[model samples]
Target: MSNPIMMYTEGLHTIPLEREGIRYFVSSNSENCKNGLKLHVEVQPKDSPSRALPNTQNVVAAEPTSPSGSAHYGHSVILSILLCVIVVLAY
Candidate 1:
C-alpha cells in the first residue's frame, strides 16, 4: 500500500492517501472519523506538470491609512521587552 501525505487540521493528522498524478480528496460530511469533520486535500505527483508563478513583483499598498492596516512591529518589541523585565523581576 502506498503511504498518503499527511496534513494537519486543528490537530495532528496523518492522511492515508498516496500522491500519484493529480489527486484530490474532499470531504463534506463528518460521520466516519473521530474528529467529527473532514478535509479537502489535493496532491500532485513530483513529476506532474504545473504552472510557475512569475518572478515579477506585484504592487502593494505602501501607505497604510487605517489602524488595522498599520504595522505594529515596534509595539510587539516593546511588549516583549516588558515581559522579559517582569519575568526577571519576579525571579
Candidate 2:
C-alpha cells in the first residue's frame, strides 16, 4: 500500500491500477470497503504474460463544461436562508 490517490469520475469508466507487481481492473460500479474504495485486483501467473485487447475503432475524448454562475449563487442564497430559518426556530 502507498499514499492514497484520489480520482473523480463523472460517468461509467474503467481504471487500470498496478500495485505490488499485480494488475488491477477497477470498475466505477464496484462496492466500497472499510479500508477505503475497494479494488478488484487480478493476479496473473508468473509464467504467463498479460494480454491487451484490440480496439477496432478510434476513441474520442469529451469536452469539459464549466459550471454556471447563476446556479452557484442560487444555491448559496438558499443555504443562507435555510440557516437563518434554523436560527430563528432554535430561539
Candidate 3:
C-alpha cells in the first residue's frame, strides 16, 4: 500500500511521512521508481518488536531539463550510429 497524499510536479512527485517527531520526504517518478526505492515506507524496529521505525530516505531532486530539453545523450548517439550504418549500407 502507498500513501494517498502526494505533491505532483511536471515530472516528479513528493510524498511526505512523519514518524517519531521526524519528517521524511521521498521524491520519485514513474521512470525512476520502477528500479529504485519506493516513495515512502516504514522500517521495522530491531530493538522493539512492537514498534515500527521510520526509514528516513531523502531523495535529491533531479534536473528535469537539460540544455536540449528531455533529449538524452544516448538517443543522439544511437541516432548517429544508425545514420552511419545506413550510409555504409547504401554504398
Which candidate leads the pack in TM-score? Answer: 3
Q: On TM-score, who's better, 2 or 3?
A: 3
lDDT of 1 by residue, 51-71 (tens): 555575878888966766336
What would you estimate as the lDDT of candidate 3?
A: 0.59
C-alpha lDDT of residue 75 in model 3: 88
- Model 2, 18-78: lDDT tens digits are 3335453333444454336655566554443345445557789898888888877997899
lDDT of each: 0.56, 0.60, 0.59
> 1-91, model 3: which lDDT tens digit per residue?
2573445557654443334443334444555556564534465334674565588588899878547754558788899999999999999
How close is every model to the real structure, measured as TM-score?
A: 0.23, 0.30, 0.32
**Candidate 1 structure, TM-score to reference:** 0.23
Record all residue pairs in model 3 with backbone atoms less than 3 Å apart, i.e. clashing: none
State the weakest 10-residue window (summed lDDT) of model 2. Answer: 18-27
**Per lDDT, what order, best first?**
2, 3, 1
Q: What is the lDDT of residue 72 in candidate 2?
A: 70
